[model samples]
Target: MAVDLNEFKHPSWITAAGAITGYLLILIVLTVALFIVPWLVFLAL
Candidate 1:
């Protein structure tokens, strides 16, 4: 499956902002999980 960008329109500022916000949200969730999961496992032991 090849990605074709020939017909893709350039993203506006709003689209760019949305993508950035989404990325940040994902990073934050992963970071929180990474930090909290260790403690959770330790507590369960």
Candidate 2:
């Protein structure tokens, strides 16, 4: 089977958007977890 690179092409903006959204999601989750764990530990004491 052969694949065509042209047929699998994505626009630059789409790639950039995907990367930016993924980065933001990871950042938000990390930020939430970072703060929440400390608070939970404090409460458990």
Candidate 3:
């Protein structure tokens, strides 16, 4: 499949902000999982 690069043109700051937001979201999910999973495991035992 051919992708068009022109369609992706945007300001550099916008892209950087998106990347930082994505990273923070991933960290939040991992932090929540770290707390929740152990509680679930303890409950299951």
Candidate 4:
């Protein structure tokens, strides 16, 4: 699916909030992965 970037140009605050939310979500996933990966590796051994 293709999205038009022009459609997203109207509201600046919404865009900024979305960007921040996406960034924080990614940060949280990575942080959880850091803890989970080691446990998985240890289980495999």
Give per-residue lDDT, candidate 4, residue 2.
96
Q: What is candidate 4's lDDT per residue for 1-45, written digit by digit as tens?
A: 999888667788688989999999999999779978888988999
Give the alpha carbon lDDT tens digit for every residue of 1-45 in model 3: 999887667688679889999999999999889998889999999
The count of residue-pair clashes in candidate 4 stands at 0
The runs of at least 3 residues in candidate 4 whose Cα sits more than 4 Å from the true structure, single-residue gaps closed, are: 1-10, 36-45
Worst lDDT 10-window in candidate 3? 5-14
Candidate 4, clashing residue pairs?
Answer: none
| Residue-by-residue lDDT tens digits, candidate 1, 5-39 | 75455567669888999999999999879988888
Show pairs that collide, candidate 3.
none
**Lowest summed-lDDT stretch of 10 residues in model 2?**
4-13
lDDT of 3 at 37: 85
Per-candidate TM-scores read 0.57, 0.60, 0.57, 0.56
Ten residues in sequence with the least summed lDDT for candidate 4: 5-14
Error of 3 at 40 (Å): 5.7
For candidate 2, write residues 8-42 as lDDT tens digits. Answer: 46687678888999999999999879998889989
Q: For each candidate in the order shown, give its overall lDDT on alpha carbons.
A: 0.84, 0.87, 0.88, 0.88
Higher-lDDT candidate of 1 and 4: 4
